[model samples]
Target: MLQDSFGRRFYYLRLSVTDVCNFRCSYCLPDGYQGKPDEAFLSASELEAAVRGFAQMGTQKIRLTGGEPGLRSDLPEIIYRLNRIDGINNIAVTTNGYKLPQRIQHWADAGLNHLNVSIDSLDSSTFHEITGHDRLAEVLEGLAKARELGLTVKVNAVLMKGVNDDLAAVLTWLKQTPVTLRFIEVMETSDQAVFFRQYHVRGDDIRQSLLSQGWQPVLRDVAAGPAQEFWHPDYAGRIGLIMPYSQDFCATCNRLRISSLGKLHLCLFAEQGIDIRPYLQTGVPTSELVQAVSEYVQGKKATHALQSHNSGAMANLSQIGG
Candidate 1:
């Protein structure tokens, strides 16, 4: 198995199929945002090859991410290919869930078992203001379809102070759904500074607010992925907090991000990533590529500066395939 310098086993890999997205979320692409780069995005076959290479090196968990992964027409085929790999234990996707209702069954048939969708607010107007679109109803319908298809569903909410900081309202709305709700703290990225100034809520504050509203924490161990999970005493589902800014969890971070343009990022806060596209284009053997990946893994910092002063710059969460 591939191991990092800290002896952390490298098993999870997030692959970006494209950087182009349909929605312009305030935190991700904000208003007046320019379009994507002219660089050619990796085709579905190329993505499959890279995933297979990682799988051969003992990577077990693979997640497909994009600015909006569902925008890709061949997404089901890509999922099918990745699922056929022998070493992959889990195949998941992080999507905006705009097209989920139409594609949920196809994705499930393609062997995608885990799905995490981005939904910032339950209010229709607030949703449009945040996402620059009016597809909130469609996303909710998709969630229901996903549940019907037997795929594990998780809702990812980026908690901003005044935007959707009504923890009580959000909790009450989510209590009626079976999907796990994850509240994510906003991080400093290049997209829009308005969100940084307008609504920067902390995870602890969110938890405290929930408790104040009579939500008792049901004791439980942390979940396996990046999210720190908590269950409500009488609630049907659980709540997760991913505090990358206020409380970073880089120590337990075993995942790496591979950009659509073939750059390998060791950490989410990393300013630059080592580009392995040239080597892949050279027809290098899988072992050689694995060795290069190991070198990159060894370079992971023990912690990120989001906890302290911001010591580094990170790509936009959408660009980095959150």
Candidate 2:
């Protein structure tokens, strides 16, 4: 296992296969990333090798991320290849659900169980406003398809102060839906100077808002990352709160992120990391990759310095595999 200096065993890997996203969410891509579409994306074979290396190091949980992982044409092949790894299990994908309707069956056939779909608002017009796309109906179709395929789907809604902060509508709709709903605080993951100030919403405010609207708690935490979950009697599903800024879950952090360019990041808020794509190109021994990964994690910081939300002047959140 990749154990860090803080005695944390890194068992989770969030790999960005590509940095190309279709939707242009205001919070994710405020200034607009002009990176070319043909820009380098990790190959299926290379991704397999990287997963094998991590699996050899006792990493079992892997989440595929990207500007939108669906942008990768070979995602199913990549998932199939990762499923073939001996020690690797629990493969998941984080996407915008734009392509799920047509590909959910194929993805499920490739051994994927969990999927996180970013759905900002239940209202079609508001959804289009947030995602800059008129495909809210398409996303809903995709979500329905995933449900029909029996995939465990989680809808991720980022709460922006003046934007999609009205969880009441989302809450009302979730009362009959089967998918889990999670409200994420708009993070300053991008280099936008006013990103947090303009978008960040407190998780407490979200919880209180839901409660005021008559939403009930489930009395248990959902094992879906850092989200604190709640539920109502009428809903068979649950609601989640991701308070990255209001509170830090760094002490329980056991995951490492690898950007689409093959840069490994120990913390999402960190500005620098090691590039491993070149190492993959040279066809080094898997042990070498393992050793390199383990060595880097040893220097991992205990917690991100997001106290001021002004550090880590990195690329847009979408480009960083958020």
Candidate 3:
């Protein structure tokens, strides 16, 4: 495994294969913004090469991300190819779940049994307000179908301050479904200062609400990523809180990011990344690719920049993958 300057070993990779998304989420992308042109997307062949290279260098798990990864017609092929790559133990996808009904079967056939769906709100009207679409029913349908297919599904939310922080309804959904649920604190994204100021909920508030319900904290595994997990005796699934803003988890960060356009981000809040597209497209030797990635990892900082100073490096979350 490649260890950074701070001794953080990077083992998980969030790979972006496309920048386009079907939804215009206010938090993820600006209003009325379109994705880059087709010429900018990563080719299937190039994506495959990069995955193999990452796996060889020590990436055991990969989560395919996008503005909405399901928008790509060839997503199944890409997943299947990665599943067959040696040293890659787990292959998953993070999506909005709008296209799950139409495209989920293909993904399952490709050996992708893990999925993370974005469920911003349980109220249909609140969902519409947050995501700019009345697709909460669709997301729920996708979750139900996922349970039926025996796929391990995890629903995530940004926990927007007063807009959709309804833990009661969310807890009810958890009781009904066999899927795990996680709530992430809003991060400092580029260009969404007003939204953060108006809607950013603190980590302490979310915890207090959950504790008030008498949920018991559960011990999380070392490889559990950034979430602090919890459980209730009555629910079939678990609850996780990822507090990026309230408390940082950079000391134990074990992930790397590869943007669809070919940039390798050492940290999510980084100002820039190394473009590996040139090496991937040129049929470079595995040794050469591995060496380049190693050198880049050595330069990885101890932690990402502060959100307050991140305004200068602010970028659309979609650009670096979710």
Predictions in order: lDDT = 0.79, 0.80, 0.79
User: Which parts of model 2 have CA positions greater than 4 angstroms off?
Assistant: 208-224
Error of 2 at 111 (Å): 1.5
lDDT for position 130 in model 2: 85
Best model number under lDDT: 2
Measured against the true structure, the TM-scores of the candidates, in listed sequence, are: 0.91, 0.92, 0.94
TM-score winner between candidates 1 and 2: 2
Residue 27 of model 3, lDDT score: 80
lDDT of 3 by residue, 1-322 (tens): 7888788887888999887877777787748447554747777777878888888888888889987888888999999988999988788899888867877888989889789999888888878877888888888887778777778888888878777776788777778566778888777666776777777787777777778888888875544567777788888878888876554567779898888888888888876778888878755777677789889999887776654546325466777665
- The TM-score of candidate 1 is 0.91
Decoy 3 TM-score against native: 0.94
lDDT of 2 by residue, 201-254 (tens): 788887887798677765532123667777777777789987776555687677
Q: Write the per-residue lDDT of candidate 1 for residues 62-110, one digit (tens) a residue.
A: 8899877887889999999989988887899999888789998999999
